[model samples]
Target: MTHVPSAAPFDPQTATIAIVTFNRSNLLTRLLTSIGEMDPKPGRIVIIDNASTDDTAEVVESFRDAVAPADIVYRRMETNTGGSGGFSEGMRVAYELGSEWIWLMDDDVEVLPDGLAKMGKWAPRFKSIQGRRYDYDGSAFYWQYRVAEPLGIPIPFAPAEFDASGYKAMNSGCFEGMFIHRDIVQQIGLPDPRFFIYWDDQMYGWLASRKTSSVIVDEFVLRRTREIKQWDMGIRHMNASSNAYRYYIMRNRAYIKKYYRELGVYRPVPFALGTTLTFGKELIRLVFVERTVRGTSNLFRGLRDGRKIARDASWQPMPPLEAATTTGR
Candidate 1:
């Protein structure tokens, strides 16, 4: 059973903008500029740097005064922890700071002038929420998905437009623009860093949905600045992926399987079939749309590695928040 926290007033001052950035110092500067433009800026901004080889630290130092009034706490990791690990650390830092709300985003997007204010309007209603965004081409960025029960996978769902309620139910979470409450974080703990890159947000959001009605509000809060080749799928857009992403997409299925197993929804045959179907779909996209066989071998390699990981007896999930003292970040 999920415990619904008592309704309390939402304060913008209680929000902490948590960002995970890598080598994209240019993009990070843009995002910081946007945050500086907010009418009432966030109380604090915690940046988790994934040990970028670039001048990311110097760039952040340049923005100390740009986002003034809002305290900026930047921690550079000893090594590149990827997006998953960075987000986990960022959320942990924000949660320990006693932030009532943590707004998680990657450095690639720029929050709108009124982004935090718009998202705050629904904070009292939805504890776990997501905001809409636009692509570099000005098209709506797709971020809608529902969790498939029993199989415990995300199924992309798109609606023509949001109705009068101003939001839609969602289980698929994109760390790119997830606005979540501390109570939800207290329940789900942190995202599993083992994922490394892909599907981490989906699993985290699905876990959050188990505790409350996770939603993506109709408000447009972000605009993506990074441009990548994309295939229009009508209802959704398929962004071209890199070799690293291709490998992780397939290999991360093992972690997904572990999640289903923990929830007692794992069925060997169905899950295997689902994974096969996923592989086949990606394979087709790589051959036809991507028009190259550069990463073909990576797909199979990832699948083989995923099976090995699934069979490993030592692998375990991150413990829930209740098991921790909340003193460590």
Candidate 2:
């Protein structure tokens, strides 16, 4: 695996915090407040506003000096590009700004006081690192994940995967607290904005692992501040997803297949089995956990759309960062 030379030391002054936010201005304020409390704040922040109709711009202005001397670049989108697009643009802006590390997160999570410091400890060794997180109730979030290579899908969080190393090698990534070195970004390019929501981070991280070992360090760095209904799944709790999100979860598999195909690892049988299992899990979530089947129709619709999307000869995967152009849209 390619290691970033020791000469390129990890420094907060060389890092940029990238946030993708939507209509939740209140949550954005809380997040910015937490960032202001960082002992050593990142050198820059790039806020990608996803065409929020709310007072998101006002909220950002209120914290203009939250981290003084660290410029905050707020770019508003003409349309809501969803989480995938926002993070894509966020990373692009930070990279163009010449940040050595780009830390990406959603606005709903609050950074722990020593989050940056903890992540910094591992930066000298790892090019792609993920920090630990807490759920709304202060329970540890299950994050350790591996990809099911034959199926080209990620296995569910496996807490046991973490051990004495204080970190575990991982092929999957979560955007909420994903700390990535710019070198990995240069190779994998940006997260595919065409994803619009689901599975983008996992694919991006997998690409990073191809260039270097990606890992999740066992250090609590952030806590989810938002509360939502969840069902305990023994190892972890599953949060209820929206109908649109459910559709994306299924439809986005096409992109996953496309990625695996490009890698020459795509398998039809295993992928089919994986898709069936995914559909079954969603059905259980909707019927047993959510106690509603109202969104069941979306599952079929998404599957159909995904197949059509897979056959589209025009669709292409994301290019490397050097070849990518940020539209700022």
Candidate 3:
């Protein structure tokens, strides 16, 4: 059944969604199901598959008729570009398609039926609007909040600060339900695919916010169906147990530092100190808490790599997406 559009202030047809997936066709199917159930469906859907060795293509093919008027653009990458690169290409395609707004999320999340309509109502006022996220257990997935200047850690907003139409000033962004305008993309450029994963969205959102009005609209909700116990203490504690996660969390700081250096939005001294503290805190977690010897070693290796990355004299900002997909890396 085609769900009729509600009396929302903004038109639903102006927004598009970009979902990046890797080896999770089931979850992607679930997300598509959620989109199909929306009362006011999005104008378009863009799926960026990171070369998954599964039935992802078939899963997307099955949705062609279900979304009705909403165009589905599926791109199966030649290689695995990781989440950052995948989203980079995905948003690039969405930009070219000419949607006024772009909603980004991972395969693990499913939108509440009213989520887009709720956000669409508020979209007329803000340039970038992020929606609230709920966990699989239906608890508020509380990671959404502001970032402290220079340091860029996710600090919690006070209980009283949360309101349906109001929003706190944001210094970072989460891709779970991030809604950004096309103009912001034009000014800030697509997210750096080189990030490859962790902190990519945060940096992307920060750049957009720096250029335009960005806020978290409390009315809309995205259900984050995956559960994790690794992150806590406001974004400072990255209790990463996996070597890959630890490496990216540590190595990516170099890119972040370089970004700030180029942007010159925040002071350099505090940014430098804060970035070092990020590695130091991770070292303690790996060494003292988890007591993983190899994890700590990888942290150190990431730190070494990050320093080299920071010192790269020829580094460029927002390199072409094609270069990121192929040899420019």
State every prediction's TM-score relative to the real structure: 0.94, 0.95, 0.87
Best TM-score goes to which candidate?
2
Residue-level lDDT of model 1, residues 1-329, one tens digit each, is: 33354378778878899999999999999999999998678888999999998999998998889897888989999999999999999998888888888999999999999998899888888899899999898988886567665555656555647889887888778899999988889887899998999989998998898888888888999999899887788888777888898898899999999888877878988788778777877877786669877887888888889999989898778776653233312
The lDDT of model 3 is 0.77
Candidate 2 residue lDDT tens string, 1-329: 65555456678888899999999999999899999999788988899999999999998998988777667899999999999999999999999888888899999999988899999999988989999889999988886468877766668755544678898888888899889988789888889999999888888888888888888888999999999788998787777888988898899889999988888888999998888888888888887678898898888888989999899988777887674343222
lDDT for every model?
0.86, 0.86, 0.77
| RMSD to native, candidate 3 | 6.5
Candidate order by decreasing TM-score: 2, 1, 3
> Which ranges in model 2 have alpha carbons more than 4 Å from their true place?
1-6, 323-329
Candidate 1: give the clashing pairs: none
Comparing 2 and 3 by lDDT, which wins?
Answer: 2
Each prediction's total of clashing residue pairs, residues at least 3 apart in sequence or on different chains, is 0, 0, 0
The lowest-lDDT stretch of 10 consecutive residues in candidate 2 is: 320-329
Between candidates 1 and 3, the lDDT winner? 1
Candidate 3 residue-wise lDDT, 1-329, digit = tens = 11123234577787889999999999999999999998889889999999999999999999988886788999999999988999888889888777777899999999889988888876766777788877666766665456766785554443424655466556578888888877678777888888887889888888877776677766546887666545455433334457776788888988888887787766777776776777776776676556666676677777788889988999988943222221110
Error of 3 at 41 (Å): 0.5
